[model samples]
Target: MIHPAQSLRTFIGSKNFEESTRFYQTLGFEVKKINPGFSLVKVSGNLCFYLQDYYQKDWCENCMLFLEVEQLDAYWEAVKILGLPEKFKGVKLSEIKKDDWGREFFLHDPAGNLWHFGEFFD
Candidate 1:
């Protein structure tokens, strides 16, 4: 059976919608749709995700996203230089380290949505 959908996009909660959009943009995701209460962001070619203005402590705190990249070190350095954690306000970014998968790191958005960035080992 052929799948009809081309991709899956995750909807992430963002309390501070404006700043949250900026945060994703600063991290290299192209802001496609930005309105009063929602945003559609694209990372690279096919990866995309949504930002909802609605905020729920339970849902936001438990949300997670995993992104794979080719240049892990560069991405880590860029995020550090931009000081995303400080700029995003209450965001946290972990150092990139090697794991069973590959070099990766963790970070959270202002709304508490966790994100894991990694370069898988082939």
Candidate 2:
């Protein structure tokens, strides 16, 4: 079995590295490397977003990544300033319904990847 504290990594397939890099950069990711067919963007400590060239068989549906932040409104505001699409449908700051755990909202990236941002108001 895998340890709970073990670091996890995610890879995203992209046909265009420049566009992918720019999109992630708008979401506050720092570009760490840029090559002809691959690029790395740092999301946080020990967490990086990998963008690889898309081939016919290598392309797979991208996965959703969640980011936890303290302030949802401020973060969303900054995201707005970055010119990301506000395509959030059923999620809002005022109406953040929480489960037994905490409150959360989801934002969809240009590549149809969902990013959940949650705050634990416990």
Candidate 3:
């Protein structure tokens, strides 16, 4: 039997390093700079990823992340109130939609990376 891993981290690419960092911070994620070109972003203690000041159009556009939240409706409301789409170029937000598995809202970052904020049915 395989043992469970302690933690897992994904590397995310950013087109404009400063803007991307600011974007994540604006979304309420904690960001800790590692160096000039790389940083760490955390939504919670156990959930985090590496944000790199690097970009490949194909990779950035195709990348997607699904983040499970406790209260998706409230989260969506907060996101809407932020007016991210108006503040950041290329940012887009979608209404909450229900599917077989759960309900979710969509957000596309400035780099065109898609994020699904969802809540699974209990």
Candidate 4:
């Protein structure tokens, strides 16, 4: 029998390890530096990913992570108040957009990784 997986984490590459770590921290993620070249970022205990000191233009630009939230509007407002676009070069944020399935807002990290924060209608 196949056992259920305990947890899952993804590897996100960064163009600059230090700056990328700071970016995530600024975005309110808990970051623990593993070394000079890597760090583990956690949105929560079970929600985490690895940040590696690695990048490829094609891969980094194409990489996208979807984060599901309970309140899209509130999250968007908080994100706006953070002023990430003004603080970090190359960071970009978009207005919340509605889709047939759900609504989401876009955020682009300095390394060009795209993040989709959304919530589905009940």
Candidate 5:
């Protein structure tokens, strides 16, 4: 017997491609292609996010994307250069404590989508 395959890709709805592209780029994602009213962002390994224009008031109400990284400090520093919300104030770089599971951080996209950056140390 064979187990079911894991997720192949995640397609998300977006009303603003330009803003969404910028947001993902800030998180280290590279654009794979751009078509009419749609854009593809490469997140990792076989994971890709396809953003398409849609008519919805709350598209990300129950959606969240988590990215796994190797180094939290370096990734955080790079994101800092891209600018973050003031809520992150007083959060020292070294103070980025790691939980029992791993190191992580939260961020909001321009379209009000919540994202989590997680790091697994072995």
Candidate 6:
């Protein structure tokens, strides 16, 4: 039988593929280059996505994903190690906060894709 779903990765767009690749690299995602227009970025063992070169206004604007990390605080701190907030001017992020469901935070990549991070309470 085929395996059930385990994880997910979203393919989002980038106006400038090279710059976007660098942005994700700074976010601590390992990248495997396919071409000038495409790359596969592994966020973790089971999470990865294809970064494709595309710039249709509506499509890029509509792209978004919820990324589930094991630890929100550590993830944010490691990302901060890259100084990505300084690296990307006017970058956006949300503070870590917990609700009934889980603790979570958010950040926006250069391609304008919104990534929300969350995990269940211990």
lDDT per residue (tens digit) for residues 1-122 in model 3: 99998778999899999999989999999999999989999999879999999999999999999999988999999999988999899999999999999999999998889999999988
Candidate 4 segments whose C-alpha is farther than 4 A from its true place: none
Error of 6 at 113 (Å): 0.2
lDDT at position 76, candidate 4:
97
TM-score each candidate: 0.90, 0.69, 0.96, 0.96, 0.72, 0.83
Query: What TM-score number comes out for model 5?
Result: 0.72
User: Could you tell which candidate, 2 or 5, scores higher by TM-score?
Assistant: 5
For model 5, where is the 10-residue window of minimal lDDT?
A: 86-95
The stretch of ten residues in a row with the least summed lDDT in candidate 1 is: 31-40
* Stretches of candidate 5 exceeding 4 Å from the true structure: 1-7, 84-97
Per-residue alpha-carbon lDDT of model 1 for 19-60, expressed as tens digits? 888888888789877777887898877788888888998999
The TM-score-based order of candidates, best leading, equals 3, 4, 1, 6, 5, 2
Residue-by-residue lDDT tens digits, candidate 2, 1-122? 96677566677765455666677776778877777777777887867777766633223334567778888767666765654554322212223446677777666554455577777766
Candidate 5 structure lDDT: 0.65
Pitting candidate 2 against candidate 3, the one with the higher lDDT is 3
Q: Indicate the residue-level lDDT of 45 in model 4.
A: 68
What is candidate 4's lDDT per residue for 16-115, written digit by digit as tens?
8888888899899999889878888999868999999998989999999999998899999998999999988889999999999999999999899999
**CA lDDT for candidate 4:** 0.92
Candidate 3 structure lDDT:
0.93
Judging by lDDT, tell me the better candidate of 3 and 5: 3
Residue ranges of candidate 3 with Cα displaced over 4 Å: none
